[model samples]
Target: MGGSGDLDAQLRAAMFAHLARVSAAHPDGVPSDVINSFRFADAPMRLIVQPGIRKPAQLDAALTIRTTWTPPGAAAPYADEVGPDGSLRYKWRGTDPNHPDNRALREAMRRQAPLAYFYPVARGVYQAIYPVYLVDEDQSAHEFGVDLGQYPNDEDDSAETPLDRRYTRRLTLQRLHQVLFRPKVLRAYESRCALCRLRHAPLLDAAHILPDHHPHGEPVVPNGLAMCKIHHAAYDADIIGIRPDRVVEVRQDILTEIDGPMLRHGLQEMHGAKMFLPRSGRDHPDPERLEERYVQFRAA
Candidate 1:
């Protein structure tokens, strides 16, 4: 039993390391082919199972849980909600709580084991969140409570007060929003910077036309712009702004600044250039939101 347990630990570590490398290479999301290609010591081992919950034959605990992406205005088959305490409320595989898959997940929670969570970012691609701990289960809801932002050592679940739980919930929701928002925005713009048309995915970001804290600031593709790091910083800092007409405008101070080639070509040369928009008109930056953001840039 000890030898088996040790091997399981080693295998889990290797799987995580492999996933980390894959994720680093594909920051947007991992393709289904790459996910299906994962192997352990020349043996077949799938990282994500079709049935949602995966309990590998070699391990006693559940290896992974997945949630498929649902289109807007469509009802999801298995709705994964956020619990009152901010943890993910993942529904059980079936009505039978004692089912093998449920039992495996329960055992994972009992042993405080970490597992991977595959969240869909596209039809056949997923963003993998790892080492997720199943903290508790809700019998009435027929679901397992998952914590995405913290580990067991981060806090004692039993000793947590309501305030602490609320704080955790806020942080978890924020992370969930970011994870879903970035890929969708980048995908809409074809993973290129809107200002300068930089094609490197790692150098790009999803910049919001309206700030997230604003009442109208929603995390939708129409309200986003795919921007490289420098342009994102410039947009946020009012060094550059985009007009409702889709024209780039460098701040007057920056336009006249006598500096290196970076300033001359990167910012000054970009002035009056037309912004590269998403192929789909529906995914274009919201004119209203851009006008609002432009107002701020003008005042700044």
Candidate 2:
């Protein structure tokens, strides 16, 4: 048993390292092809197991959990939701708590073993969040409480004040929204900068047209624009702006500024150029939201 546990720890560490590299290369999500190719110690070990839970034959605890992606405008199949205490609620496989998969998860919770969570961002792709701990299991509710490395495994939830719990929940939701927002927006734009048309995925970001704190701001593809780092910074700082007509505008001062080639070509030369919008009309930016944000840039 001791040797088995040790091997499990080693295998988990290798899997974490492998996922880290894959995520760094593909910030959006891991494609099905890449996920299917994963191996450890020169042996066959599937990272993402089918049917959600993965319990390796050599290990007593579950090693990973997965959630399937639901198509846009479609109803979700699972009732998975965020708990009031800031934990993620993952539903059980079936009604039986004693089933192999459920028992593996319960054992993982008892052992306080860390597991990787494969969350789908799009069809046939997943964003990996690792070192997730199963803190609690409610058989009657047919769900398990999951912590996404935010709190220590042994932390007492009951000790938290109501205010603290609310704050934590808000933060958790915000993080989740941001995570899910980026890939969708980037995919809509084909992983290219809307302003400069840069095709580098790592250099691109999903810039929100209206700030997230704004009442009308929502984390949808229509409310976002994919941009390179410099352009994103310029957009946020009002150094450049996009009009409702999808034309780029450099701030008057920046347009006339005397600087190195970067400022000249990157910002000034981009003035009057039209943005590269998504191919799908439904994915286009909202004109009203753009006008509202343009007002801020004009004032600045």
Candidate 3:
């Protein structure tokens, strides 16, 4: 109770600080509590407040209050993300490399941080990126609906309440970008590289299905091919090509001037192989992306 009292003092200070900053829409005759509550919902705490005092709304003036946003010292980590299938993980975000949030919490931070806060690599996908920040346990969160204890991904036998669409929006955006380049290319190839069977991440590269610089176009994922690096470069230079049905086609131009065991070993040998398949059914490359790239392949 004593601690809560202290929290109220801090919260009150924050609330009034903002109230002092702006003129209330209903300043005239509004009671101090109502004025205070409204201010709490505004600047310095733009909490989406409602009737229940549990959220951003201010509660009974006499009752000790606290914000739900965790600060640097929170027992719970600062960042949390929930997945499409309802998976969740938490992390402490911090700038310092030596801090626990930076070291121990890095993985969770990548998974759970905000879309604005998360670093973006695949254009719009925020699924796997985050900026590190120090853990300050003293801060408050007016967006208090998320119960750190209620985070589901466990055998708690409890169901989540009031489905928060915030997470859903983020994941969908991320998945959409992957659709642009990945699944379509993998599917076009029938899921295996034409040359080597490098079935792992570190080795695979999704190359343009057409020569990178086709007169007809701009780049799109469908214009891609899931080939290993060797094949990717060869395909880009028209040294290697594949028909829409996945049969490999080597350019006669390369055959005469570049006669060698290396070319023969990689390109000529792959003349009749099929394309690689998409990794996940959901990740199958876009047919249009393939079609766009295929046209470039024909011209080259």
Using lDDT as the measure, the top candidate is 2
Residue 67, candidate 3: alpha-carbon lDDT: 17
Q: Estimate each model's TM-score.
A: 0.89, 0.90, 0.37
RMSD of 2: 2.3
Task: Report the lDDT tens digits of candidate 3 across residue range 119-183.
Answer: 11222221111121211221232111222221234343235333543454344444434333443
Per-residue lDDT for 1-300 in model 2, tens only?
A: 888888999989988988888877887778866865768778878877767899989889999998878897888777678875665789898889899999999999998899988889788898888888887787888999887774452356678787876676567666666777887788889889999899888899999999889997889889999999999999999999999999999999988889999999899999999999999899999999999999999999
For model 2, the stretches where C-alpha displacement exceeds 4 angstroms are 83-87, 153-158, 216-218
Q: Is candidate 1 or candidate 2 better by lDDT?
A: 2
Name the better of 2 and 3 by TM-score. Answer: 2
Clashing pairs in 1: none
**RMSD of candidate 1 to true structure, Å:** 2.4
| Model 1 weakest 10-residue run by lDDT | 149-158
* Candidate 1 backbone overlaps, count: 0
Better of 1 and 3 by TM-score: 1
Tell me how many residue pairs clash in candidate 2: 0
